[model samples]
Target chain A: MISKVLVRLKEDVLDPAGRALTEQLNHLGFNEVKSAMVGKYIELNMDTGDREKQKERVQEMCHRLLANSLIEDYEIIHEVIEKKP
Target chain B: MISKVLVRLKEDVLDPAGRALTEQLNHLGFNEVKSAMVGKYIELNMDTGDREKQKERVQEMCHRLLANSLIEDYEIIHEVIEKKP
Candidate 1:
């Protein structure tokens, strides 16, 4: 089973890397760019069980290892690419 | 209009951040984690057009701003939540 996790900061938090990128982008003449934020994508392949249980395991993984729940929020979605429809 | 961009390192590229996280997870006793990689997701709300054109603009944005095309591969997908089905 393959699960994809997307994690990002809550909107109210300030993003230093994003601010730095905005500064650099303005210097690069991408002057019209309005917003910039940074985050992460994590993919996990596991030897797992039924779909619902797989999802639960992925969520637990996110809560335990994939994200800092205090500042970052994460979502897990899965795809079964190898199996036929 | 809204577009979601997911960007990640090409399969052969080494991810230093991910390696660091793996070490940390190991220390935290997540002994079963076999692999870890880090990437990004960017959501943009724009004033746009037909879904295809909107997607084109998003792809251009990913190429020009959201991703470092040299080392990353990115995909842009759009959702029109404003006009519900």
Candidate 2:
């Protein structure tokens, strides 16, 4: 199975990284660019027959350490792959 | 328009952060997890009536600054939003 987590700062939170990118974009003549945001993309490969259990475990990982729940939001996407013995 | 760029380390490169995450996952009891990868997700908002031009500009941005072409790969996703004006 493959799981992907995308974590981004909350709208209210200040993102200096994002701001820096936006400025760089402007400097590069992308004047139409309005805003930019920088975030984390994590990909995990795991083996588990129980889909529900895998989802729960991934969520726990995100909340416990992968992301700061107070200042960021995360979305998880997963795909299950079957292996032949 | 909104553009999302996902930049990830090449398979051959060593990712200490991903390794650390994998270890943490194991400690947290997700033993089935085989590997984990950490990457960057960047979002940009721009206005360009010319889709082709916008795409080119975004690609340029990725190659020039958003991603390290030598050690990373990037994929861009975009959406165009119409304004009521």
TM-score of chain B of each: 0.82, 0.89
Off by over 4 Å in 2: A80-85, B80-85
Q: For residue B85, what is the lDDT in candidate 2?
A: 94
Error of 1 at A76 (Å): 1.0
lDDT score for residue B38 of model 1: 78
Q: Which pairs of residues clash in candidate 1, taking residues 3 or more apart in a chain or in different chains?
A: A41-B39
What digit string (tens of lDDT, one per residue) describes model 2 on residues B1-85?
8888889999999999999999988988779889999999888888777888889999999988999999999988887777799
Off by over 4 Å in 1: A19-34, A83-85, B23-32, B83-85
> What would the TM-score be for candidate 2 when compared with the true structure?
0.88
Scored by CA lDDT, what does every candidate get? 0.73, 0.90
lDDT of 2: 0.90
Error of 2 at A32 (Å): 2.0
lDDT of 2 by residue, A1-85 (tens): 8998889999999999999999988998889889999999999988777789889989988988899999999989887776799
Model 1 docking category: acceptable
